[model samples]
Target: MWACKNEGEDARLYQAVKACSEFAISLGINIPTGKDSLSMKQKYKDGEVIAPGTVIISAAGHCDDITAVVEPVLRKSGGAIYYINLSGDRYKLGGSSFAQILNKVGTETPDILDAGQFKTTFNTLQELIKAGKVQAGHDIGSGGLITTLLELCFADRNLGASLDLSALGDQDIIETLFAENIGIVFQADASAEAILKANGVVYHQIGTVNETAQLTVKNASGNWSFDIDHLRDVWFKTSYLLDEKQSGPVKAKERFDNYKNHVLNYSFPLNFDGKKPVIDAAKPRPKAAVLREKGSNSERELANAMYLAGFDVKDVHMTDLISGRETLEDIQFIGAVGGFSNSDVLGSAKGWAGAFLYNEKAKQALTNFFKREDTLSVGVCNGCQLFVELGLINEDHEEKPKMLHNDSAKHESIFTSLTIQENNSVMLSTLAGSTLGVWVSHGEGKFHLPYAEDQYHIVSKYAYETYPANPNGSDYNTAMISDQTGRHLVMMPHIERSLFQWHWANYPEGRKDEVSPWMEAFVNAREWIEKLAK
Candidate 1:
């Protein structure tokens, strides 16, 4: 998709489109969709402001294998870092980030000299990724090669590299370091070297990884070293400043201080094999109802996960229950999906909960289901809010758990780590003592517990107890909760969204299975229901 914002300049717009069309024709590809906003000039009494003509290209494509993809992080055990310049040795500084910072735009600009070579290099990198040969990969863009090398170090823990750019044999050291040359830099092993050689793609082994979190460079001018941590903090300071405006100073400071300290350290179950155990086909799959409200969006994901875990899934919209079209009579399991139910304008799940409380049929149906001995239920995000509002988990207690606004004062949409604590939750008990990554996207997700910690069945807690990682400032870093009986569960994060390994932001290396460990939760629920049925 192409999105253009341009001043009233038809000739410039035509030229831009013509250039793109010519490039697409050369590549034998077609951009079938686009949008344009020609009105970009603002007339002022003093002076007129004309926005620069821009065309943003957005393309979506399928990858060969998501599991094989490498992050732009310099690993601790990283080998040599190599560079494959697609700019064909033309290190143009014009229209580059370096020029922008220097308050100058030079005459000549960087361009894709050879499209065929570019395609070959792209495909070669993809092949190396799929073959599990490349440990890390980064593109030399924006800030050029120096920035790329430093960024790789910035992403990982205590990782740095020494790169000698003297091999480039460029007369100008500034051009060699700062020029906007279209290129690829990667950390690879010996096996990758063999394949890279076979591909006949010109690549230079430029650097070696080091344990010290500092970057060292060697060029024609001289040797230079930089403290990676200090530079990273300098880069992050801007982010913290920006965050302070939105997340509040206190929350932003908390995040800034704790982000590096609170690393994602996972611990899996001793018995988790990452393989699905075969279940008997003779028995009928247990019925599970995926509950959703007006603005709910994660219902289909919940339903699919349930189906994968040996349950016959059914979609149950709030309207169905409210109108008495479908009662919670047949469904053994209930999965309340995560989303902004009723647009969350009513504050969290107040509007959603009101629909059930005001309507006799919906209220009675839900009440009956919870009251039943054989039924199991799980609510997530907005659904979690609704469940707390209705006092479903601790209906007996006068002061029930309350869902409040996040500590950040905004919706916390993050993929963070959670550790499964020892609990009797029918769906999640099997995964106790395990730490996993889950998606959290919500505004009012914090749990305000008036009672003692032991009173509520806490199933999972955020691995990090600080801001951002904890996402919502829930009591005791509580990520998930269950009832006294362990039949009903509620969580702020979306486990259904993290059903597959590919869904994870950063999965454990060497685990090749399609299904992630979170799938065990649904499986356990299915097994529990089957045993109860028997």
Candidate 2:
């Protein structure tokens, strides 16, 4: 008969009471309740007079409520009263509804048990509780099962119980050790044999309660047990701080400093010359005319390779170039790196296009330069979208093509296999008869191209194919698509990231022969540009 101010609080009270009742019923203990106050009082007095081992589980509701009512009656009856106050941190069960909240935050499924298995296990447990055979049941809960088991052994005065965990099909040992569930408790001296006979319940008799305050477990292989007092001393009080003191603080600080320096100063090998050598050129390298944006790791790597292949690179921001201070005639190859530009809002590529279009002077310069084919403008990932939005590729309408959200409705960064289309376009011509493996990390990367009925037929003139094919659910399985002229290529995937063997799929052991083809593609593109320059 617990009263609460609101329905939510009432629900919590009901759950607490129901859990206590279930635990009592499993132990073959009965509690009396009645509408009349006198009858309830008489039942309490009789139970107290009987001198049975009674435990009253109550939530802290109104400071002196339990002390005023049940405390006196239990004291007179010569029984001990245990009060359980429900005021502490509350963690959601691993298999409960609250687990979905973690999925939204991390975008990864955390539960080891699938929905079907969880439902099956829950249903079986419910049915077993309904029958009178199960004398006591405990929910596997916080600090997980290990802590719960230790607490149980402590409470029962060093009584150990055998647990058969074999019924948990195909689950990892670590997962079982830390799984959580609320409203569950372990019951001592329950009808273990009858409980096992029930449908879908599998358990093992592993060990028993002892008088010496020790816990022991006997699995199929062997027996291993520990004294509770010794375990507490070793686990609770043992400290690693003493060892740290022996090592000395100055030595630790020096070691940590060295580690940080090693990480920051590390440089990868650019050439396969057997010996790792620092890339320091004697004379000043010729600088490329094009203004390059501050590149990411991938962009920087590609730019370095371009420098090796004889191209001048000047890193500049978009704002600096749009001020009319940077001229296009001086630049041979204008390169933009692959990254989430302008936060990838209003669809990918759209933002970059808007920035370029809104700038009157920059737009005029780009239009004049692009028409002459003197400047080779390249964009990657969101940068690719920028090229599309600016009408670098000939489009029927002024509106830019759209890149939609991934069909999976989640962001998945992974490597996929890709086959090149052998169209006569400048981009694909270099990639003909070759396949590539590239890394992709993007949410909105679906590419759409306009097609006409009579002018460019769907099957023949229009090239629409998906592949390392259609990772982001693009309309035509398009990993990369080019404009009609084939001079400007816009691709959503990041080829620069996959430049090294470490970035390749199944490197070292698997696909050992698969060197990143995108590196060669860039070099080849550079060679083509060099030829065009001549």
Candidate 3:
């Protein structure tokens, strides 16, 4: 809140506060949190500069189920666009972006004339959302009705809309399309219309999602066509210009040039239902260890994933191994969780590797664990660096592989895809030929492979072989690799982070699955150990 000085000609600051209070009271909303600088009027050498007061509101609503929340992305087929004006006010352009651009501020401005109606509309929409009716949704804001319609088509690939602004009445063409009003434009199928009408919700069937990538806008004036791709690129240009300033010209353009070309494409295993398998409580749970150093933060997530996969997960810190407090004797599976171990001061997992390479007890425990025929290990992010540094995964190679800084020389954090190849890894063998989305976040995740690709048991490759999708640009586009025995593995992607349905960047609709396919890895590990024990 930039509350200007109250010593103005008409006490503008006091009036703003009064207006805000009245609106909130009418809406039954509280102004519980806000900070203000009421003394922003600066006194110059000659005169004073009375800055205009500005107040912006940040509203948050609680979600019962985040997965059920409606998205703003349009589906390819089976949806009709609808609009309901919640603002109960006349179309107004005063103080709007259009008016400001033209330097013409009219007397009246757009607002929610009926707060009760607005709330009713919101609650009605929530009911529709809970009923799985809302396909896509976007609010009408500054740039007005037409702009909001265009934005809904921009998010998805090859999506377009055939718009008909006729139902809004024979109002002025400019006012009907560009006037800023408080409303929402949503996409839903025919079944939702009865529920909306039963509640006496005022709505208009505006358009439908088209197959070809083109926006057909029809008004009383004329019919107009727009290229969605061209508009999307134009929309992204402003952000790209700012990115160029921070990330430099080359990298920014490389990102801008390829950001929209690659949408996430995934292929699941033939029988991989996204449901948590029912575990028999009477059976013994498998034992697994989640190893961590001081700065590690991902152990809890990894441990939770293992526990859910019918394993008794233990958090084993480096201190425990160094002090000989916890040996790998009872542990069947070990996971080196991802994080900045030792704050990654020396490099990614350099300090972590030193503890095992130099310390006798820690080194012996790890060596003995690797030697055990019953044990299995997998490393992620910094842990991947640790395994490479210690030459644990590639013991056969005299010149061991290394983990290096990403080709971008920046920390890459992305929810991306990994195509699991045909591999004999005990944990990943069943998941072969499956393309899954997982989280990848690390700076030095790039694999500097010294040996031939055929020599290593390459388990996974990235779905997209370019900058952000490939993330670290590992050799041969490798996202993960396993030892020849398939007993041990190292990868940059975090399967633990992507265990649930909400973890994915874009998931298939109507799934209602409790877990994502990434949970298969942990389940596979647990089952493998269980079978071996039998």
lDDT of 1 at 217: 90
- Count clashing pairs, candidate 2: 21
Evaluated at residue 156, the lDDT of candidate 2 is 28
lDDT of 1 by residue, 1-534 (tens): 122354337767788899888777776678998877767777799997777677788887787666777788887775789998987757879878889998997988887777777777778888888777889988988888888888998866778898898788755777877887889889998778777788778888998999899899988789889899888888799989999999989999998888776677788778777786565789799999988988998888899888889998889998999999989899999988888888989899898999999999999999999989999999988889989899998887899889999989988788889999999999899889999988989999999999899888899999988887998899989999999899999999999899888888777766777688888899999989888877
| Candidate 3, pairs of clashing residues | none
TM-score of each: 0.93, 0.44, 0.93
Order of all candidates by TM-score, from best down to worst? 1, 3, 2
Root-mean-square deviation (CA) per prediction: 2.7, 24.3, 2.4
Best by TM-score: 1
Q: Please say which candidate is ahead in TM-score: 2 or 3.
A: 3
Model 3, 400-497: lDDT tens digits are 98999887777888888889999989889999999888999998998889878898889999998887788787899999999889989899999888
TM-score of candidate 3 versus the correct structure, residues matched by position: 0.93
Point out where model 2 deviates above 4 Å.
1-298, 396-400, 425-428, 452-469, 507-515
Count of clashes, each model: 0, 21, 0
